[model samples]
Target: MSAEIAEQPAAARRTLERLMPQRESLRELAQGRRRVLLAARGSSDNAAIYGRYLLEVVAEVPTALAAPSVATHYQANLDLSDTVVVSVSQSGSTAEIVQTQQWARACGAATVAITNVDGSPLAQSADVALVTQAGPEVAVPATKTYLTQMVALGVLADALSSGEALAGDLDQVPDAVSRLLQVDVAAAAEALAVADQVVVSGRGLLLGTALETALKMEETCLRPVRGYSYADLRHGPISVVSEGLLAVLVAAAHGPLAEPMADLVRDLHARGARVLGIGGTPTFAELCDLHLPGPDLSEAVEPIASIVPAQLMIEQMARRLGLDPDNPRGLSKVTQTEFAG
Candidate 1:
């Protein structure tokens, strides 16, 4: 699992190299599609959350995350004639995800499959297949595959946008990830490893990062961890914050969402939570009890790099807890959930 985590940079480069060339074609699909619906489960679903933001922000198109059960369980027949359904999965064979793609096509939506497997069911059946090129990820928990999926989604966002929204040829991401690998997250990991309560929060673009990070902790660290958007945290989850709680906040150094996140930091601190900041600027780092400063990148793609710190931290945290990430209890690399209907 550690090796798989370290391979993210290379995996991202491979994905970028393969997908960037298809920009025009993918953009053509974007130009014709009136809306988008993304489908996935588990880690891939978190990537879909990121994709939701990217497509809406960059393409100015209405986007939504699909509730596949609507079709699989209730068998609701709805028209998706003008929608583009982009389904993401590390292994394209996950039963429900593949069924979702098949159902979307049945609903008249143009389908796009983003998967690591070249010709898996989900990929072979889509109108366009954007294989992740992340190679075979043997770890029980997804690492390189997740990052590669994000890269592919970012490329799709660029394709959907009128101008270059992702920016910088997307080459900087791998280097940024490589640089973050050098950061010492042991202190933060050690601190959080023994904490009784942990919550991860990020607003806007990095919300998915928070969700994915929390999942990593939950799976590998064998603990109960919750992830919420800063906006939504106040709605319910914030009440649990108090002394001995460890909060990890994903914040950009400066952006529209930064102030609210900073405010969240202050609020968490007030409530006596020990806050660990991720990907914040040096100035913002002062607000955190412990901070792991991440690479400064553009808002559109910063999330790609923003997640690396937590990935590193969570892996270290898992090891600290004496849990083997490769053998995270009761988890398989690919989960298959087929509809019984």
Candidate 2:
């Protein structure tokens, strides 16, 4: 698992190298599309959230994360004409995801499969396949595959926006991730080592990062963790958050979101909550009991960089907790679910 974590930088770089050549074509898939529906499960779903923010904000296109069961179980016939359905999966073999891509195509939507495996079932089904080629992810919890998928989505967004948002500079991400791989998070992971629960929060794009962080912790460390947007975390979850609660805030997207996140840190501190800030913003980092400062990058690409440190921290936590992250007890690398039409 740790080896895969270390491979993230090179894996992301390779994904960029492969996808950039196809950017014109990838963007063309969404060209003239009225809306986008992203479908995935687990870590890829979290990456889909990152993609959702990028598509809506950067590409200026309306996007929604797909609820596969709505089509599969509820049987609502959605007219997806002129829409794009992007399915993200590590193996590209998830039954529901492949089926969703197929049904969306049948329903008149352009289809895309972003998967690590080339020519997998989902790839075979989509109009264009953005294969990560990140190689086999042996660990149950995803590290490299998730990062590569986000890179693929970013490439598509860059294409759609005519290189405005990302500015044809997605290549910087791999080095940024490489820098984050060296930061020490052993102290933070150790401090929270005994805690039974952990919570992560962020606003806007990093909300996806927060959620992914929580999921990684739960998957590899075998602890109870939940993530929510900055506001939603306060709505009800804050009621139980008193002293000694480990609260991780993803506020280092290097934009307007950082100040408000610092405010959340103060609020949590006032309640005696122990805070861990993820990002490089000085104001926010100063307030946290622990801080993981990833490379400062455009908000569009920060998730790819920032999440690396958290993945490393999870590896450390697994070691401390004396558990094997690569083979978490109740989880499988790919989860399969299908429904008959």
Candidate 3:
């Protein structure tokens, strides 16, 4: 897992280089698309969350996260002719995801499959495939594949939007991720070593990061971690904040949303919860009992970089708890649901 994490910089660079030649085709597909829909499960779904933010904000295209069961179970025959449906899966063989892509293609939508496997069902089913060159991810808990998926989504957003600024930001992601991977988070891991539960919260794009982090911790460390957006946390969940609870807040420093995140951190701290801030301005650092090193990038692009530290923390926590992250109990590398393609 560590080696796979370290390879992300090169993996991202290679993915961008490989996708460059296909940019024109992707742009052509995006030309008249009325909306974008993404489908996936587990960590891939988290990547889709980041993609939703990118397509809406960067490409200025309305985007929705698809509920595959609507098509697979309920048999909804909605028209998707003017939509671009993207199916994300590491193995590319996930039944629901493949079924979603197939259904989208059947509806005359331009379908794209983002996967690591080249000849998987999803790749064959889509009109175009954006394969993540992360290589063989042997771990049951996806590390490199998740990061590479985000990078692939960024490349796709860049292709669709034709934004030079976003293109440059994508180029810097590899280095920023590398720098984040090198940060020493041993202290933070040790701090949370004894905690049985944690609350991971973030705003905007990092909300996906929070979800992914909580998932990783639960899968690897056998800990109960619940993730929530700050707004959702404040809606009612803040009542759970108490002396024994550990809250990890992932926020972006250079955005309008930063102030609210900082305020939440302060609120959590005042509520007798130990707040661990992942990103924000100096005020956030001051309010947080502990702060993890985070990438200094726009919130849209920061998800790719910010998630690295959280993954590292989970890996460290798994090691400290004497659990095998590569092969977590009761989980497989590729889950085969009853709905096969």
Counting clashing residue pairs in each candidate, in order, gives: 0, 0, 0
- How well does candidate 3 score on lDDT at residue 96? 79
Displacement of the residue 278 alpha carbon in candidate 3, Å: 1.1
Candidates, ranked, lDDT: 1, 2, 3
Candidate No. with top lDDT: 1
Off by over 4 Å in 1: 165-169, 338-341
Report the Cα lDDT for residue 19, model 1. Answer: 91
On residues 84-197, what C-alpha lDDT tens digit does candidate 2 reach at each position? 999999999988888788789888899989999987999887888899957788888998999999999898888777436684458789888888889998997797687656
Q: Measured by TM-score, how close is model 2 to the native structure? A: 0.96
lDDT of 3 at 291: 89
lDDT (tens digit, per residue) of candidate 3 on 1-341: 77787888888888877776777778787667788899999999888988998888887788999998887888678889899999999999988788888888878789988999999999887888998888888788998899889988888887778455377788888889888988888877877777645899887777788889888888888888898877888899998788888898888877777777777877887888888778778888888888887898776799898988888888887899898878888888777667356
State in Å the error of residue 281, model 3: 1.5
Worst 10 residues of 3 by lDDT: 158-167
lDDT of 2: 0.85
lDDT of each: 0.86, 0.85, 0.84
List the candidate 3 regions with Cα displacement exceeding 4 Å. 162-165, 339-341
TM-score of 1: 0.96
